[model samples]
Target: MKNIKIILGLVFLTISSIGFISCEGDDSGPATVDGPPVINRVTLAINDSTTTVGLRENMYRIYGENLATTKEIYFNDTKSYFNPTLVTNTTILVSIPKETPYFDASDELKVVTSEGVAVIDFPIEQPAPEIDSFSPVAAGAGEIVTIVGSIFEGLESVRFGETEAVIVSSTSTEIQVEVPEGIVQSYIFVETLGGVTQSEQAFGFKFVIYDDALKEGWWVGGWDGSEDFENTEQVKRGDFSIKRIYNGGYSGFQIGNGGAPLPISDYSAVKVSIYGEQNVGNLRFSINALNEQELGVILQVEEGQWNDFEISLDDPALIGENELEVFSQIVIQELSGNSNVIIYIDDLGLI
Candidate 1:
């Protein structure tokens, strides 16, 4: 009986040992995860490492290891939305909220994973201003030019080369500024809290003619002597410009101040600054000569803004060099279809 009991005890101890080993060595159960997420670098998702500073509401990528289990992300303590499909073992794609507070130094990016959480200090900043394009690329002083770009928030000022432009209106992505005096064909500049940005291409300005409204060289007629035209203070430059409203009575409204004929000896072209009610086109400009060979140039003026029309004197389609030299009257006939069309003229001169 003692020998049998010993054999049974040995067998029971062996079985108990096997059970313990099965539980400890089994790979079918939940596996132990390794290290926490490691962040190597952060870069723009569009252009890669070109910019380390992430733009608000723009997509960015975080490169690291062990990120597949990422659960959440935060920018400056504000939770950022991330897509599961964009999260992988080595990268996490996220969109920085547009409302994320900018210029915060203590901002950090947090990544929570199943294994552990990781953090990296980051800075949230407004993207520097950028200028994609501007309207009326060439205009005289006091004419409004619209600037379109990104990150115009907190716009401080605008610059035309070295001259400062007056801000008309500013938003997150657009700015309207009047061309300041003394601006040449130079780069358009913009300043904001983020930084200053300049146009890659240069803009132009037209030469001055009758920019001052108080000038006495204008002789406007053809409509009844009623207030058809006036040298009003609504000028694009100094003080005044000629504003005309056609009441559809005259065959064409005439503009001539009876001043001495302007010599086109040193000039190659004539430019006029014009603004109309709405998208008026096909304005006919005639240069009359004592020789009876009239030259014509057509101008297409945009609506609701100042437009500069330049007519080349040497263009074969317009006039001869001799006719341009002896031109007497600069006639502008309003054929813009609007019956009661309103137009503003400034800086009508030879360039």
Candidate 2:
């Protein structure tokens, strides 16, 4: 009986030892993962960098396990320049701080994590559009002027000083905007996504208000034949008349036939009063210089009331060798169809 009891005790001790070894084998701790924290997405918001406007708020999302409750965000470099705030364990909210070295539109964003550091490739672009030039600078207050310049693709607003001009239309390279009311100054500036460009001051003086005596030497002409010489004229009242004819035909007026062309070489232009009775013919106005003839063509007339026209003659040839003469014969001709339309002529001058 003593021997049997010893065998049972020995068997019980062996079973307990085997159970302890099995428990030790199953004691492996939790598995560990090795890698950088997975980032799902990153976002940024920016205001116009060119102007004094402030920056806007934006978001960036981070994903994966082991994300610490505290984190750091940066821009451009890892030196903690952005100083983003930790909103949550998996998210961060940051405001773009005032740039030290000046904000560049090409700057990017980056983030740091407890697992590792990750960078965002997308750059933050915030720029103000600019305008280089505006056509018809002296337009009426309500006139539509075309604003031209670079980087007009994303225009936000256009302003004429304090007043906001109405944008008529926009394109990648150009924008058509109308002048606002209560604008007295001829000079103005245009604002865009890039910057502002100043416009040349408009000539606000009324051109037609000048006295008739001030226009003593102006020339006037038209191809339509009228009973009164002064009524049917197209070119402004100036020294020379340039008329155009159709189908290889020619028409012109000479200031002085007796002298060797007018001698005044520094005259401004030939002025005439003209209206387009028809669109089929062109008018040519020629001036006789001592040696060469300078000529210009007028094709901007439509059948209507008389409009004043001016053509500059800076060329040295149109003036005569002696004093300029006023008793010159004006010639007219039809280039194609002999419409027999006569252009009127009056008030020809050199000044």
- RMSD for all candidates, in order, please: 17.0, 18.9
- Structural similarity to truth (TM-score) of each candidate: 0.39, 0.31
Model 2 lDDT, residue 332, Cα: 35
Which digits, one per residue and each the tens of the lDDT, describe model 1 over residues 193-212? Answer: 88999898777633344545
- Please write out the lDDT profile of model 2 over residues 90-109, one tens digit for every residue: 44445554341123443544
TM-score of model 1 vs. true structure: 0.39
lDDT of 2: 0.46
Steric clash count of candidate 1: 5
